[model samples]
Target: MIDPTDFKQGMRRLAAGVSVITTMENGQPHGFVATSVTSVAAEPTPTLLVCVNRNVSCHDVIGASRSFCVNLLAEPELELAKAFSSSAHRHLRFSTHEWRALATGAPALMGALASFDCELAETVSVHSHSIFLGRVVALHLPEGPLHPLIYAGGQFDTLGSRARTL
Candidate 1:
C-alpha cells in the first residue's frame, strides 16, 4: 500500500473546490468543510457524494438526519471555509446570516455559488470515512460570477486571472 504520508502529499498536488457540508438535527446545525464532494450521476437521478471522516462531530448528525447541503464556496467565502474546517470554531459555523433551511431542512448557504440540498440515499463505509450518496432534491444557483475557492499544497488558493481559455 502507498504510505499515507506520501498519498497525502500526492493528493495535495490536485486542486479541489472547497465546500461546506451542513445538516440540522433537532433544531441545531452542524457543518464541516469538505473537498470530497463529487457528482456521481445525472441520468436516473441527480446524485452526488461526499466523504466524511467518521470521527467528525457532524458525521453522526448527517447520518441520523439523512439530509445535507453542499455549499460550494466562492472566493468571498474564505472565512466561512476556515470556520467550518476547524473544531475550535464549531460554535461559529452557522453564526453568519447567510444560512437558511432549504427543502431538506439542511442549512444552506444563501449566497453560495451553488447549494445542493440533498436527501441521504445511501452510505458506504470505507476505511475511516463514510461516503454519503445524496439525491439532489433541490438546488440553488445564485446569479453572479463564480470565483471558486480551492485547496492545494496544504493551503487555500483561488484562481488568478491567468487561467487559459480552451
Candidate 2:
C-alpha cells in the first residue's frame, strides 16, 4: 500500500485555485481555507462541490446550517488564506476580515474574486473528507477585473505579469 505522505506529495502536484469556504453558526461566522472546490453540474440545476475534512471546526456548522459561501480569493488576499488555514485564528476569522452575508446568508469576503452562495443539496462521505454538493443559489462577481490566487506544490501564486484574459 502507498504511504499517506507519498500520496499527499503526488496530489500536491495538481494545482488548484484557493478559496475560503464559510458558513454561519449560532449567529457567528465560521470558515476555512479550501482548494477542493469545483464545478459539479449546470444543466438541470447548477451545483458545485467542496470537499471538507470532517475534523475541521467549521465542518459541523456547514453540515448543520445547510448553506455556505465559497469565496474565491484574489491575488492580493494571501493573508486571508493564511489566517483561515491556521487554527490559531479559527474563531477570529470573521472579525479579522470584513464580510457581508450573501443571499444564502453566508458571509462573503469583501474583495473576493467571486462568491458562490449555495444550499447543501447532498453529501457523500469518503474516508476523512465529506464531499458537499452545493446547489448554487446566488453568485457575486466583482465589477472590475479578476486575478485569482493559485495553489500548488504547497505554495501560493498568482498570474503575476501574465495577461489576465484567455
Candidate 3:
C-alpha cells in the first residue's frame, strides 16, 4: 500500500473540472464550488454525482429539496468560483450570480459552460461528507466554445483545446 501522504499527493495531481452546485430553499438560493461533479451513467438514465461537505448550507438544501443544479464553470468564472467557495456568508456569494428555478424547482446558474437540473436519487453519508447521486431531468448548454475552469494541487487552472483533436 502507498503511504497516506503520498496517496493524497498523487490524487491531487489528477486535474478536475470545477462546478457550482446550486439549489433554492425557502426562496433563498445556495451554492458551493465543487470539483467532484461527474457523469455516472447514460444507459437506463442519465445521471450525475456530486460529493458535498455535510455541514455546508447547500448540502442541507439539497437534502431538503431533493433537487439541485450543477453549473459547469468556465475559465472566465474564477471569481465566481472563489465567491461560492468562501465560507464568510453564503448569501453574499449567491448575490453575484443570476439564478432561475428550473422545472425541478432548483436554482440554476445563468451563463455557465453548461447546466444540469437534477433530482436527487440516492445519497450515502460517509464520515464528514455525503455523496449525492442525481438523475438529470433538464439540460442546457449555452452557445459558446467552452474553456473549462480546472482544479489540481489546490490551485485553479484553465483548460485549452488541443489542435491535434481538430
Candidate 1 on 23-79: residue-level lDDT in tens? Answer: 999999888899999999997999999999999989999999999999999988998
TM-score of 2: 0.92
Q: Residue 158 of candidate 2: its Cα lDDT?
A: 84
Superposed model 2: Cα runs more than 4 Å off: 163-166
For candidate 3, lDDT tens digit of each residue in 56-150?
87788899989999999988888888888888655566677677777787777777888999999999899889999999999877898778899
Residue 58, candidate 3: alpha-carbon lDDT: 79
Which 10-residue span in candidate 2 carries the lowest summed lDDT?
A: 157-166
Top TM-score hit: 1
- Give the true-structure RMSD of model 2: 1.7
- Candidate 3's displacement at residue 72, Å, is 0.3
Better of 1 and 2 by lDDT: 1
* TM-score per candidate, chains pooled: 0.96, 0.92, 0.88
Of 1 and 2, which scores higher on TM-score?
A: 1
What value of lDDT does candidate 3 attain over all alpha carbons? 0.86
